[model samples]
Target: MARRFVTLDVFTTRRHAGNPLAVVLQAEGLDTEAMQAIAREFNLSETVFVLPPERPEHRAALRIFTPGTELPFAGHPTVGTAVWLALHDEAEGGGTEMLVLEEKVGAVACAVEVTGSHAGHAAFTLPRLPEAVGTAPAAGLLAPALGLDAGEIGFGAHRPGIFSAGVPFLCIPLASRAAVAHARPDMGRWQDALGASAAFVYSHETAEAGHHYHARMFAPTLGIAEDPATGSAVAAFAGAIIAHEPPGEGDHRFVIEQGYEMGRPSQIVLEMSVRGGALVSARIGGSAVVVSEGVLL
Candidate 1:
């Protein structure tokens, strides 16, 4: 069967920058195994298989996959797919559009801005808020896994922990921006220190002014060497952020800088709504551009 597919650079307006995603549009008849195989062939951070929505009213049902496995939900794919749909499948010319994407986690509500240029912005409130899934290994063990010294492992109130909105990641806070840039996965110790869990390393010092954070993500177990940008990690990091940063009751917006070192420099906008000193809701927003489109045989 022939299916249509488009590749997009997510979290950035540039064509070659940001975390890359491949979205298969005519994926109605592909099975789970076939989808996974296709994802491996594309070899991007994540690939989206768009299926018919169970509720015909919704936009589409998405099955996100890394080369190694399927994800209940993923950030880049959702953002990229939404923009693609708004510009192509659900075009309304030039206005904000509201749609729903059904993922294994649940329904995700998205708002996309239709624009004059190819770059369009999309934001989706997380279907599931982050929850503490488990404890993190000590700084000593974590440091060796990422080729960092124990001293560079943590700063301020931030230590290492595991959090998941839908996909789980080990949130590791480093001492400085320098420390974040110095990270290199020690493949020998990585698997033992963290089994099948991706690592999200971040620092307070950022590459861009006014940016709240700078981050890097590593997920070899999921067949990703390093991700240019990671929305799910940022979403999960919100749980850690609220615990450590502890913002007062209100809506807070933060710009996260990522992928600078990889040359794909990407930015992600994280919005958190708080009430009574507790987080109530959160959303991830970014822009994506279609780089190319072709038919998959």
Candidate 2:
């Protein structure tokens, strides 16, 4: 039998914007090699394979795969898959209900509330605590690799660090929006500096959009020069910011805008809290749109 897949755009209010993901439903019999091959064929940032839930408490088993390898968890895939499943009636309680999914990382929970029959319409929330792996990249090597001058890097907020809710990314804060917009990595220097980090470089700009931040990410090692919008990176960024920001401030929440240079405008809401030297729960949420609904076969 031929396999089937559905493609959807995530983190945007319209189709063709946001990150694209392919969902392979009911992929119980497919092996790992086959899944990877299928993922490679799809060639999206990530693809999701839905399997039978091992335990009764879980909704469905979700496996996330990048073009290169399988990831323990990912933000867009989780959000897009939940919405897709609900639209197809595979998830519980129909379109208005919250969907709980099982993945390698842990049980993830999200809700898809439909606004209309329009292809690009749905609100998604990843209601789970983000866990940090506590691994960070060195600052010395990172500065030169991104073509960032010593003066362009801020002292407190610009410190190079690593953070992850699921996948670890090296978070770098630049001095200004101009610095972020003009940043182009020195491939040789980046490869040399972050070889051991296995992390991507992410930068941001302050925005007036309710939350005061804009963001961008680069992962040349993964064969992606830039990601249109990265939810995982946003979550990781939130973790690092909460830890680095000064005390005596109330909780901070921001909307991170990205993908302008790529022409696919994207938005991500990052929320976090830090207390007693430990960063508390970090959550990243975004809007998704179903650009197309067709079978891979």
Candidate 3:
């Protein structure tokens, strides 16, 4: 059988600058093994298979897979898929539409902004709130793992910790952008320190003047040595920000710049609402461009 697929650059308005994703449409009969095989064949960070929604009202069901394994939920795939669907399925007029997509984690409600027939942006509220899953290894243990000194391992009130919205990541707060740029992962130490979780290293200093943070992600266990843009990581990062910054009640926003070191510059916008000194909700939004479409036989 031949499956129609679309390739998109997620989290960037331009092509070839953000994380690339392959979305297979009309994916009805493909089994789990076949889907995993297809994901491996794509060799991207993630591949999404679109199926009929189990619920009658939702837009579709998304099965997200990394090269090595399936994920319950992923950021770029959700954003890119929502934009692609909105552009192709909706009438060509500048307006916003709401879409519900079912994933393994839960149903995600996405607000898609359409600008034209082919260009659109999408944002989705996190289906699950991020929480600290566990504390990370001490700075002494994590320093060698990330090729950083113990002194460079943390920032004010932010240290190494594990957090998850739907997916878990070991969030490491570096001292500066220079440190984030200079750090390298030692696979041996990484295995010892992080074990099963991926590492999300970030700094308050950013490469872009307008951006609020700079970041890099390493997940060798998922066949991703480094990821250019990671929405799920940013989704979970809301918790870390709330813990450290503790914004006043009401809505706040930040732009995160990532992937500059790898040459693929990408931007992710994070919005959060707080009340009573607690984070009430959060959303991840970004622009995506449909680069190409092909039939996979």
Candidate 4:
């Protein structure tokens, strides 16, 4: 039987300006190999397979994948998959302010607010509470992997670290947005240095551009060289900040700007707070516009 899939460009307000994703609906019987094949066929950055919920309280079970491998959890796939379900009327809409989505990481709560006409898409928030895993990375090895000079990297007195809300990324601070924008992954070195230690290299600049930082992600491990907007990485970045940054003088919420270097121009909002010893209620959310929707066949 021929399977069907729908594609969308995520994170950007306009079409064709963000990361592209494919959603495979009615994917109940497909095995792992079949799913991977389907994802490769779409050839998008990521593809989501929607499955029936194991429990009645949850909305759906989402399986996320890049072209190369299946992921336990991902940022855009979670958001895009929810939107896809809402658009197809598989999940409820309009009546409820929040929806709970089950992924491999755990159950996540997504809040959707319809900001436009009923026929148009709505913006949603992902609960992105992430945790800091380690203190810092070896600058000697990491800087060159991102094609940057050691002086071009920023330690900010906090040091580079490993963080994750769902998926882990090594958050590296850069001296300038230009450095981040010019980043090209040195795959061989990155593989040798990172080597299952990190799934991606998230380079960021602090110069605000309608957001707290301009960022880019290079995951040769995942077959992606610079993701336009990384929801998971943004969430992890926020978590890392909360763990490292001094007590805020003001609000903690901020936006992440990414994809400009790649010409896609994407934005991700990272929302979180610190309570007790752990980072509580971390959410990574963003907007996505459907660029095109057609059957795979």
After superposition on all CA atoms, how large is the RMSD of candidate 4? 2.9
Per-residue accuracy of model 4 over 1-297 as CA lDDT, tens digit each: 555677777776677787788888778888999899988888777899888888897778889888888887788887776665565553353345566778887777776544333222333444445677765657788778777787876646546778877678888777677877766778778776676544333344554545677777877678675577777777677766775664444335777887777778877776665566455555667766566656654
- Give me the displacement of residue 252 in model 1, in angstroms: 0.3
What lDDT is reached at residue 16 by model 3?
A: 90
| Model 2 regions lying over 4 Å from their true place | 90-96, 118-140, 196-204, 246-252, 273-279
Model 1: colliding residue pairs: none
Runs in model 1 deviating more than 4 A are 90-96
Worst 10 residues of 4 by lDDT: 115-124
Give the clash count for model 1. 0
Candidate 3 residue-wise lDDT, 13-66, digit = tens: 888989999999999999999999999999999999999999998989999999
lDDT, candidate 4, equals 0.70
Scanning candidate 1 in windows of ten residues, the lowest lDDT window is: 88-97
User: lDDT tens string, model 1, 1-297?
Assistant: 889999999999888899899999879888999999999999999999999999988989999999999999889999999998888843555434889999999999999975544668899999999888899999889999999999999889998989999999999999999999999999999988998889999999999899999999999999999999999999999999987887888999999999999999999999999999888999999999989989998
Model 1, position 181, has a per-residue lDDT of: 95
**Error in Å for residue 106 of model 3:** 0.4
Q: Estimated TM-score per prediction?
A: 0.97, 0.86, 0.97, 0.88
Q: Could you list the CA RMSD of all candidates, in the order they appear?
A: 1.3, 3.1, 1.5, 2.9
Model 4 ranges off by over 4 Å: 90-95, 115-128, 134-136, 197-208, 247-251, 276-278
